[model samples]
Target: MPRKLKVFRTAAGFYDAYVAAPSRKAALAAWGAERDLFARGAAEEVTDPALMEEPLAQPGTVIKRSRGSAAEQFAALPADRPKPKRVAKARTAKVEPAPPPEPAPKPSRDALDAAQDAIDVAERDWRKEQRELAARQAALDRERRDATERHEQALADLDRARRRAQEDYDAGLAA
Candidate 1:
């Protein structure tokens, strides 16, 4: 099995890595090597340094060799077992048609009517709920629009007031 090293960067300045070694020691070694490579400015691939810690290195997160090309590693990885062959059903002459599925028992007329009534009631309630939701959404939209318009009007009023005050000041100075 070809070994794979997955590497990415974190937002911080430190180099974070996950190395899926053949053993835990190998993984630790890989991480140390990556840290050294980063310190020496020899590593090209780096993810956020924040990824180096617990959650990133925990169970499922992938952190391996951040310095090498992931594509090259993926290409280099060996293929597993070959896919199983599909057996053709038509080639087997002993095939017989499957038995038809048994029909479900039908309910009595009164039971069917009651079920239909229940369905109709449920449908009506669903439609009512949909209409209520639509109305609520529309109301919320209207409220938001009104709030925006009010904010704009208030800003305009403030600007006008400031301009008037400035003009009054100028007139007083002139006088």
Candidate 2:
């Protein structure tokens, strides 16, 4: 016979325990088993309240139950502290049919034409701006190149004049 397992869910995750086993011990073992599974690489954290009996599900897990002493105790406990939800194996149910599609709205031809015109005008303006920027950049580059060349030439001329003056002074001294 398949062992009746009491499935419990804790804040961390879910675990299964034999119903014949002690509730406290089984719950603790289940908790440890869940932690071990998590350590071994399980991603989902179980957050269901631990089950008190094998045949019965806990408050958060079950939809309805008689308010016995256990329920009373649960209620007596501060409202702030309540049982967590039970995580169970998902039930297999048939999916509902998809909703019908709605009709699509059509745009007017004038609106479409206006949008196209705006896009074309923007593209033309963007191209014109790009060309103007390129021309300005080229002109600045040429100016910088010419200025550097003139400065270099001026330095060379100064060096030549200094050398010639030094040679003339040496010749006069020799004479």
Candidate 3:
């Protein structure tokens, strides 16, 4: 007979992951956790039915739920006192720039063009970085989906093997 399943929960970065499994070892395998989270006090058996519902429904699948909202987290932080405001001194006299009639050296177009080129280069770099991040995110999403598909396939294979073995045993006993 298979072992009875229990719901387990752990706090992962930005989310809490839960899984229903037969034991801590199984849970760890399902969670893909290399270290024993239970031993480190990072994970625990969840007995509460309300919390156990989703995990039980999808046994062995890691169900991640967002831990809390930004607002809630912000509220938890300690309040800092507002700093005193600084008042700027009022200017008694303002120095005006030389009149346009003097046409002071007519700001060089070369310097302006160089600054624009630098800005263009910076913008291009920013865009390339954004594209790389997007590609990475897509890859991560694909990997997650592949993992889930593999898990489902494994479960089906196990089920088929178990059924075939049981049938064979019965036939052998009957013969």
Tens-digit per-residue lDDT, 1-175, candidate 1: 7554434332222323453334444443544444545445544343446543543455334454343467865776788889999976776578679999999988669988999999999999999999999999999999999999999999999999999999999999999
**Candidate 2 lDDT, tens digit per residue, 26-72?**
54453455344434443222334443453243322321223346666
**How far off is residue 79 in model 3, in Å?**
7.0
Q: How accurate locally, in lDDT, is each candidate?
A: 0.62, 0.57, 0.93
**Could you give candidate 3's per-residue lDDT for residues 1-175 as a string of tens digits?**
9778899999887789999999999999998999999989999999999999999898889999888998887787789999999987669868688777854676679988999999999999999999999999999999999999999999999999999999999999999
Q: How many backbone clashes does candidate 3 have?
A: 0
Predicted structure with the largest TM-score when compared to the true one: 3
Poorest 10 consecutive residues of model 2 by lDDT? 13-22
Candidate 1 lands at a TM-score of: 0.33
Which residue runs does candidate 2 get wrong by more than 4 Å? 1-106, 170-175
Model 1 alpha-carbon drift over 4 Å, by segment: 1-107, 168-175
Deviation in Å, model 2, residue 124 alpha carbon: 1.0
For candidate 3, give the lDDT of residue 28. 94
Clashes of 1: 9
